[model samples]
Target: MTLQNQSGTSTIRPTIDTMDLEEIVELRTSHMVVGGAALARDANGRVVFVSGALPDELVMVRMVTAKKDFATAEVVSVTEPSASRVEPACEAWHRGCGGCDWQHIAPAAQVAMKTDMVREALSRTARVDQPVVVTGAAIAPWGYRTTVRLAVGDDGRVGFRSRRSHDVVALRACPVADERINGLLATVVAAGTDELSLRVGVAGAELIAWGAPGALVSGLADTVRIGATAVVHEDVAGHRFRVSATSFFQSSPEAAELLVAAVTRAAAGLDLGQCTVIDAYGGVGLFAATVARGAERVVLVEASASACADARHNLRGQRAEVMEMRLEAWTPIAADLVIADPARNGLDKSAAARLVQTGASRIVLVSCDAGSLARDTRLLREHGYAHRGTEVLDVFPNTSHVETVTRFDRFAPGDRANHPDHV
Candidate 1:
């Protein structure tokens, strides 16, 4: 076999006989790597990666995909169990549903691994030396997910997608889902006689059914109503955000509160009191309203028309400007502070370019994917922004998902003078 580098230089790859490649090796699971598993080959010259295996556990695996230099494998069996390995709390999670990736791993290890992953990505990818602070999960790891979208199979089964595949994995119950939502799985399965897909939000297994226009589950009455919007009562610092069943609200309210606090604190040093603030990709304007108390003017930008309408209604009496436009299409107006809470993909290149061109003095970015966040951070830093600090909030507990609030400041003469290479 041979491999070609980016420059078109070709190099011959090492040869391994079928016998040597077929051998199974027992490997211990270390920290969770990018996708999963952290393993190295042994003296037999075979590549290994820990899968469902836990730390200090010996697992046998067979190489399935071997490139010229590296290889991928599938777990064959676990010969030894790790001390930290615990029975997964979710029945659906243990049955190969990709919804919860780190269910088998211990909860404490999950948080530590996630934090390390962020720090490693920033240091290796973004080349930042600043310490990344990580806050543990805000609520119980189980039964905290308020929203879930499940695909219904033709055989009258509702389930999640298989691990790294489009195939649907039948599920009975999801432990991470709110009890209200999980309880409805049976009803949903029984109700899906002709429907091909179902997306339900759970607060406790009570179905918070949402359609194109959105609807509320019947029994939840004490729910606070912000304008026309209504959601289960969950207060943060005395502020109640009316989160509809289907509206885009953070699943982990505790984590979201911390994230909001971090963003507010990061922007507190800036002079937002007299400057225009742009909240791009603003969901229900949670952060927008939270930070608007101090800003002279706040522009809430959202691509979802329904979300925009909901935000408008939510901010009915507040002093804010609502714009229903995509971040990529919206023209950047002059502003002192720019706070963006984009989707999992983070900001697109064009949007990032426009932000750099706008040269906002202070940028507060809230991201769920660290890899994308690091990439965007590097892009901004290249366009004359300097990293101030970053804080990680555990939004999705018992899973690989995490949210971060990163603060960046415009470059000054003395700031990058010594580090000219930063430019």
Candidate 2:
């Protein structure tokens, strides 16, 4: 069958009775897209997003999802491979482990692809023409994840849920997680819980796990701690943060440090010493205790009560306020600068509008999703804020998740001194 590809060239595809009858199709991929998929076109000229594939590679994929305009597939076989492709560190990845999507790509190439994704999102979605240069930070490819959430299968297997489905992929060892975490993977399989969260801190020596309050973890190591109220203290950017079982931290201390550095650089010009900073969605006081610690008053707004409890303890001695409420509903307070590290969904219009109501002179947005970052920045722009710049950190190695720290300045006539939007 002849098909029109993204290159606008005629290509031959396998002629099948129907996608229902023959789920597999051969296609050559074009460029990398968000969510660790490569863009391609199938026989019917419908856009095909293929996972477990790389840019400019010809691969046979099995279609799992079908829509009128697009389809999603997972690579079945690679007829032609790219040089950047490498063996995944974790053997479980080949078994459909959903932890790391880009484990097949070389580390350096992964960083480049993340940068490309961020730049394309800003340019295409946000319509920003100001360079949109994304800075990619290098990180270790394996054995760096300090925190992991394991799903328990009905057959008493422990591992991660497969992408596009809830089916768990049982694993013998997880190479991407910290070595200590891998040590406990087997012990937690029989913990009598459907879900488990594991974490290691204190230079990878302290191990903490959380499951049901009365989990059967007697088989776990003596050094390992587990319970519903369990918490881990992580040291990042020269400050120790108490992270509760419910609070979210970076995958590793190194990832947290890189993010802190990038955010500090994005807010470099602000006089933090005299400014009042608002750490929106501040989990466990990461920014309140590090990047914005120098500010006169730091307000950390988070909806998680458990996280707020940890933040209260972590932000000790600093002039900080812990408000346990969603940022979208929090009353706008006076703050010179706002550092919003929103979750994957990014800042919605209501939240963005509320954030702008703070009358903050500068806004630094830390986003983990490229598309959401683009939409949020565009919303802020519509609220009379000029996009200053964006810096991306590829801390989550071997994954398509891109961490972006963006800066914006409020714009208004006759407010050159307070709001330097022109600068």
**Top of the candidates by lDDT:** 2
lDDT of 1 by residue, 1-423 (tens): 564422245755333333256656444455445555655453345555655655555576665556555566666776676666677776666567887777777776666666777777777678876645565444567777766667656564667887757777877667787665655565453232322222232322223443223322222223312122334434554466555544677775665677778888888767767888888888778887787656888888888876787688667777798889888888888888889888888887888876666667888999888788888878887777777777777668767787888888887766655331353
Residue 362 Cα positional deviation in candidate 1, in Å, after optimal superposition: 1.6
Inter-residue clash pairs, candidate 2:
none
Worst 10 residues of 1 by lDDT: 218-227
Q: What stretches of model 1 exceed 4 Å from their correct place?
A: 1-23, 28-30, 39-49, 53-58, 78-83, 135-137, 164-167, 190-207, 211-236, 244-246, 417-423
The sequence of per-residue lDDT tens digits that candidate 2 reaches over residues 1-423 is 567643467876554325562467678898887777998887656788989899999897888777777888888888889999988867777777887888899988887888788888887788887535677586797888888888878876679998657899987678888888888886665557887778888553678887766656544787787765777778888898887777899988889999899888888888899999999999899988999988999999999999999999999999999999998789989889999999999999889988999999889999999899889978998887877778878888888988888888887866665342333
The parts of candidate 2 lying over 4 Å away from their true place are 1-21, 413-423
Separately for all candidates shown, the number of backbone clashes (residues 3 or more apart, or on different chains) is 6, 0
Whole-model Cα lDDT of every candidate shown, in order: 0.66, 0.83
